[model samples]
Target chain A: MSGGLAVVGASRRVRAAHYATERPRRPVAALLARRGELAQYDGPRFGEAVFVTLQAIDLTCIRGERMIFSGLTFSVAPGRALLVRGPNGVGKTSLLRLLAGLNAPAVGQVRWAGGSLAGRVSYVGHLDAIKAALTLRENLAFWLAYRGHNRSLAAALDALGIAHLIDMPTRYLSAGQRRRAALAKLLLVDAPVWLLDEPVSSLDGRGIEVFMVALRRHLAEGGVAVLSTHQELAIDEAETLTLGRNP
Target chain B: MMRSLWALLHHDLRISLRQGNASTSVVVFFVLAVTLFPLGVGPEPQVLARIASGVVWAAALLAAMISLDRLFQADFEDGVLEQLCLAPTPLPAAVLAKALAHWLLTGLPLTLIAPVLAMALQMEGAGVVPLILGLALGTPVLSLVGAIGAGLTIGIRRGSVLLSLLVLPLFLPILIFGVGAVEAAINGLSARPHLLILGAMLLAAIVLAPLATAAALRANTE
Candidate 1:
């Protein structure tokens, strides 16, 4: 409760410098090199939309008898990301669901440019949601078609390094591979906002690097992302918001 | 929205095809349960013919129940239900697609096969067409009404029994009319009244069940 706001006190530039010094140069360079290959992918960008914003005010979430978190507020504009960090059972996923309009908040409001998040946000939760019996190609194609978006399935699979496994059933994939396939849905949709919960949990180091590249490109296209995680995302200029139990 | 609904329907059909066992189990149960009555009773045509319509109708009701619990549970557990709720196409429309797909896999097959099974049970010639027609108009109502039960019981563990409890009472009208139509034809009376009532129930179910199922799904997912 004491240092929650202080977590966002550090300037974006200062935090970027701190993150650079915190990581080893060799792997960082390797990650950057991999990201460069994925940078070529350009899906439908939300560029022309004048105002794309997500805001939450006095948000509160409760599970059973416990009040998980309360009095939380944050905002993410186009070209920016909001990173929610908290320990397990602190309502990180609940907050993301609230913003996604999947769950309503007990108190206060979550607004997206004065409208609901429905139809404008693409959400990826803890469960991969991929049909194990379906091939990766079919699964991605279904999601793209469901969202009414005509994005390239081949490029999305290629960017996620699962192009080789496209024709294989998702059941044969390892946990990390399955997670990467799920993450590819974000790239396949044309939504203005992305609400991801523990999106990197099962991803390997290389998979994380690919995801970072996709996320960066998404922000560059004037799309907003709000994700919750316990680990560092290492994205420069991303806003940090921490939630905890109120005393 | 139309494209999304079509996509969901196609995707659900593919999944049902891949699973394959659910529909097969329902059909197998329908055949086995229908076959049992003749063996349990004497092989006399009088007895089998007397009870043929009720036995087949009852068995069909149970068979349809076998797959009802599965209508929304698979998608709910896999997280696809949430994605479906968020889709630009209205959630009720998606529910309709899923229910229609469910009917195609479960009810439609039962309708086609019930007549064959009825003939095996020594059903008289008079009851033959009435049995097929009654089933054709009735099974879709089972699927539609069963979806509401499936949605309401999704969060309960070992909910199959509860699903039956919730939906069986609603299924009585369909079962009554289905068996009644065949009985009337066997008795040399016109079966049109009963068949028309079954059709009316199907029409009402098609219009209303999707809305109830969608609401229940929203409550469970939230």
Candidate 2:
């Protein structure tokens, strides 16, 4: 029994180490890729092409009479991800909300792709952002139409493995399934920057794996994501931005 | 932009229809409220006729109000409203589409049933058309205006009552115009002016109410 307990403890330590190592690699890889792309492009071509850049300039957010955070600053380049971490109620979500332009910052700005973040970035919060009355298929279709994606709904649903639930009302879905359905909306959209708050909250192990894969694919395609999550994510490369503390 | 609006309208209407009981509940409330007048006041045909237009319209407004609180509450709770706010199309336009859908689901049915309830109250046949017309134009305004209240009270624990308090006063003008049109038609006077005013109100709401609603939705959601 003691030996078995030792084995379990070792595994947990290994997993924690793996998790710690996994976070920073994503942004390092992004920087490397940017460097590689820059090398491939001649000087003029690199100079002329526009890349979407996200910069949170000294942001402060207040929620419910409490100051969540202040003087938070960070920037994410295209093809990168910013993993925000903090203690509960420290305002990781509020910071994302401000960065996503859902709410005004008490004092600062979140700029996107060389412009104001407004109308440019997509923000997904903890609440799956799905309508229970509509079928999963109809919900995706409506969001696609609203976002002006002009993409095929079948492909998006298939990507999320929710093609089977296409006709099912969203209220009938399990928590993990509903999160997948919500993630499917992100697939249908083509926004350059994504601000996701606790996106993996209800996802299962397999669901989290699938989400990581999807996110990697998104980054590879030059999309930027800033996600706040407490769970350790296994990504090939990522970076952590701890809020409410100087880094 | 227009396509987004149409899609929002289509999706919301389809959901309301498939939900079955929700649409019926609002209509049933309208009927029950209309039925109570005769029961309470004692069914005298002349007495019913005298108060029928106001009673039916008031009941319809109250029933419509009952359902209005749910317009954005469910979406807000389920996080769908966040996705909507994130859409490329402006949030105000989407909100207008939703308000339009709410009118179609809750307000439109109430308008359709008004004539039947009016007849039960011994309202003159000629007045029924104007009553329906007034409701058609007026209820959308009620929905659009009520959306602002709904948006404001979203996520509040006691939002339903707060929604009623905030919106009922705003609904008074619509109530006055709707009942006035029916009364004008009953008296064989031209109801066109009242109908025109109702249309104007609807147009103004279509333009202004959505902005207010979208702002409120942002505030409440944040």
Error at A55, model 2, angstroms: 1.0
Per-residue CA lDDT of candidate 1, range A48-103, in tens?
13223566767777777787777776667566788988778777899888888888
Give per-model TM-scores.
0.89, 0.86
Predictions in order: lDDT: 0.81, 0.78
DockQ of each: 0.55, 0.49
Best by TM-score: 1
Docking class of 2: acceptable
lDDT of 2 at A159: 75
Worst 10 residues of 1 chain A by lDDT: A6-15
Summing lDDT over every window of 10 consecutive residues in candidate 2 chain B, give the lowest-scoring window: B79-88
Question: Which candidate has the highest lDDT of all?
Answer: 1
lDDT of 1 at A22: 19
Task: Tell how far residue B98 is off in model 1, in angstroms.
Answer: 1.1
Clash total of candidate 2 = 8
